[model samples]
Target: MTVTNTGATPARIRLAYTLPAGLSDAGTGGCAPAGGGEHRCGEWASAPGARFSTLLRVRVDGDAWKRMPLSGSVRVTATAPGAPGVVSDDEGFAVLFPPGPPVPGIRLAADAVSFDISGGSSGLEVRLGNTGRVDAEGRVEVALPAGVTVPTPPSGCTTVSPARTRCALGTLAAGRTARLRLPVTATPEAQRQAPLAGAVLGQLDPRSGPTRQVQMSFRITSAAALATPVASPPAPTGSQGVLAAEAPAVSDGGGGGSVRRTAILLIVISTLLVVFALALATTSLRRRMTAPVAGPSAAPTE
Candidate 1:
């Protein structure tokens, strides 16, 4: 509420007002509860066009559901010194009971994610969500089980321990969601099903806020475990055995197989090319050998 001094001369003033139900003065500007729900304030000095402002903190008292859709008028009258018996002014007011906004409730989205520990993983991804009416400020912390490691933490995050990571989220507004991928790696013997634990902590001691606890768990798998074994072909005998023994063995689980496959392919192609060239030479020599006395016939014709 604002009160403007529109009079020509600066003078002290007094105010008398009665608050309707659900409306309460916050005891600001020296306004005190006179008696019942009425309040009295001032003898305040003011200049022309100077304004005074105060806040009316409101709340729903008693049964607001049924009492809602109802309104009441409030009359605040101000009088200057020596202006007795003269009605200064009058206006009507409506009482409102708007429900308070919900507190910021930031929580993590603990979705189950699969990660490949056999050199197929860039990192683990963490998702977040908020369920509340206000914005929230907090940090997200992720901890991994042993054998799994964070090669590089996600943006806005840092590693507190070998297995733990924390990412600070300054303000997570309600209804806003986010996802961040944390760079990770694992050894061959790393723990499977990398358990990712997260918690959202509030900023203050419940008055402000931190993140609400939201645990995110990860499931990690290794390529060796997931890969199906391939049966090796029977060993060749005689001449083929010599070549087979010189070539590297094949494995279904590791990347070395890819390299071995290319090398074997090149060897086969080269052998085929050499055999084709030798066959052409042999055919030409056989034709020459089968040909009869061409040199004698040419000499006779000349």
Candidate 2:
């Protein structure tokens, strides 16, 4: 509140104010109750063209503010030297309680995730942050899609059922973050394009009200899509020749064996015929030798 003396002389001023119910003065700023239940600041002198100001702090009742409207009025009286006592009309004002700080806002870092169904157990870290100005206490409710299994619930979380997991978030301070490691196994039947939903249901401290619900959702992507592609290894040098050399020799069925046996038998028979021919020639020669002398003499006499 301010009081100004615009006259040519110094002035004595008296200021008074009234607070509506559900509000109380902290009794500072030299304010006291005058007669007739009006709070006042005693007479103070203000020089010509000078202003006097004071601050008044008030305490508000939360319950009352929540229940009803608030309004009040103020009056000022000033007496200048050699001037008619100046009186100001009752100035009325309305106190509007601006909306209170909202309940804590729950935020998820990522709204979607991909898990490899064929890959063994996989996990997702659900990071939750409080975006509101107040500390929050609540449970984080997580619902997994069908065919998605939670092998182990995160610490401080309970398995409500096969598809639902709930974890106690205790008290989350404003601007702080918490993490829930949701270990889950994706069955082969787990399908792509599934939905994962999560909610933080709780209350803001120092206020009794309905549980606030902050919901977030995630899209499920196939883990195979997120997998890294493995490159094929290079082939060894000279592999074709090495493979051929190491291969076992194959022969046609019984025909190959018969052909080989026939070749050996023909070779043995040719060798025996040569030996018999040589022996017969030798024997004939010996017989000729024994009869040759008598034959030669008879031919000469003729």
Candidate topping TM-score: 1
- Evaluate model 2: give its lDDT: 0.55
| TM-score for each of the candidates | 0.36, 0.35
Each model's lDDT? 0.50, 0.55
Worst 10 residues of 2 by lDDT: 237-246
Model 2 CA deviation exceeding 4 Å by range: 1-105, 109-111, 191-210, 224-302
Tens-place lDDT per residue, model 1, 7-70, is 4435455666665555566655666777666777666777655787766554446654223222
Clash pairs detected, candidate 1: 200-211, 201-210, 201-211, 202-209, 202-210, 202-211, 203-209, 203-210
Instruction: Assess candidate 2 and give its TM-score to the true structure.
Output: 0.35
**Worst window of 10 by summed lDDT in candidate 1:** 237-246
Most accurate candidate by lDDT: 2
